[model samples]
Target chain A: MDQRSIADVTVLSPTGRIDLDTTPPLQDCLLPLTQVASAKVVVDFAGVSYISSSGLRALMLGAKAARAAQGRLVVCCLNPAVAEIFRISRFHLVVEVQNDLAAALAALSSSAAAAYRHG
Target chain B: MTGKPIHMPRLRLVGQAAEIGPAVDTVRRFALAAGLPPESCDALALAVDEAVSNILRHAYDAPVDSAVTIDAAADGEGIEVVLADRGRPFSPLDRSPPRLEGGAADRPVGGLGIHLMRTLVDRIDYRREGDVNRLTLSKYRTAALAAGAPRGEDGADDTGA
Candidate 1:
């Protein structure tokens, strides 16, 4: 997993499978970040080939925290398998999901969008 | 449906969350060797993962002390995975489906495990025999066959992979 900041948007790129045993690191990276007030976060699943419902559970908790804090949480770049899982779970209803990282940043705020463009 | 499972060894492990990955991996390999497509193999593997996770979470108080057994068999049609645990008589299919109609705030997080198991595999059956809780998850080659087949009634013939 790699964490980076683009403008105000915190992007977390997690690789490999996110199942029962591997979800804690993802939760650790996301939960506290989403808890911050007005936080803008993007989870990139481009490198993640698979994610079980356990991973979705973690993201749901993060989404709740982000909503409570009046922040934004978006996930982007899902591979085919992961995308299928998301579709089955209907996770897009709970948290914003974008096909492009740029779109995710744009949905966060105009400033983050511009920052992504500038870089 | 009467296809005898290929001769693969059944696995018994401590009913701990950590046992999920290895068990799923074994099933994935077994499915692939049975000629299931890559995506089908992965999907079947996910169902196994969720089932074991449910057993670890809901079935046992001391997961390390209890045992979860897994077996996989595949024939020309598809694959079936059997997971049995000695914990309480927990029937996951009996739980209400996750309400996916609403947004995150009102959405429930806890129920997706069973829901995913339902969606990932073609069919899931839970039965309690004697003191054992037995859950069977099946993924059909017909599902993979249907994936590339023309869309029609035949495509929905069996459980999807």
Candidate 2:
């Protein structure tokens, strides 16, 4: 997983399969981000082609954490396979889903988007 | 779409969390060679991955020395995977589905694995044979896919081989 901060909105691009063995790192990297008040985080799945339930569970935890913290967690650029996992799990209802990074960035507070452009 | 088992590539591994990935990949390669469609293959792989994880996580007291046996066969009809573990007599099919109706905070965090294993494939069966726990997952090929030609070898990912 490669992470970078875009004007306080953290973008996480996780590559490869997110399975039982691979989910702990993701949870470690993601869970704390959602705890900050009004935190904005976007997980980019462009590099991910497959995911299992463990991964979905992590996302669920992130969503609940974000909700508790009054923050936002969005996921974008899911391939068809990964999208099917999300659909079957009904995770899209839990976390915001977007088409791409740009859309994900746009879904946050306009202040964050403005910061991205002007930074 | 239950066809007679053609050939079996039995995979036996130590029942540890790390072995789940290799087990899923082996079942996937078998499914791919069986001429399953890409979507069905992916679903089967995920189901297998979940099944193995469940066995490792729930069945064993300590999985270091235990074994999980996987026997998968792909006929022209569909794919069938039989997983056996000697750790415990747990039945995953007996569990209720995860509550998808609620918000994330209201939902439990861990039950999605069993739900995915149940919903991803067409059929799932569980049986306890004496001291062993066996779970079978089946995905039948559609009429078009069964009648169509096999996928090209180029489509196979080179990770496990």
Error of 2 at B124 (Å): 1.1
Q: What is the per-residue lDDT of model 1 for residues A1-119, given as tens digits with 9 covering 90 to 100? A: 79999889999999988988889999998999999999999999888878888899999999999999999899999988888888888888988989999999888878878988998
How much is the lDDT of residue B86 in candidate 1?
A: 88
What DockQ does each listed candidate score?
0.70, 0.72
Question: Chain B, TM-score, each prediction?
Answer: 0.83, 0.82
Model 1, residue B79: distance off in Å is 1.3
For model 2 chain A, the run of ten residues with the poorest summed lDDT = A109-118
Give the winner by lDDT: 1
lDDT of 1 by residue, B27-74 (tens): 899888888889889888888888888787778766355588898778
Best by DockQ: 2
The CA lDDT at B93 in model 1 is 60
Candidate 2 error regions (>4 Å): A114-119, B1-4, B143-161
On residues A1-119, what C-alpha lDDT tens digit does candidate 2 reach at each position? 79998877999888888988888999999999999999999999999978998889899999999999999999999999999988888888888999988789889857667776786
In model 1, the clashing pairs are none
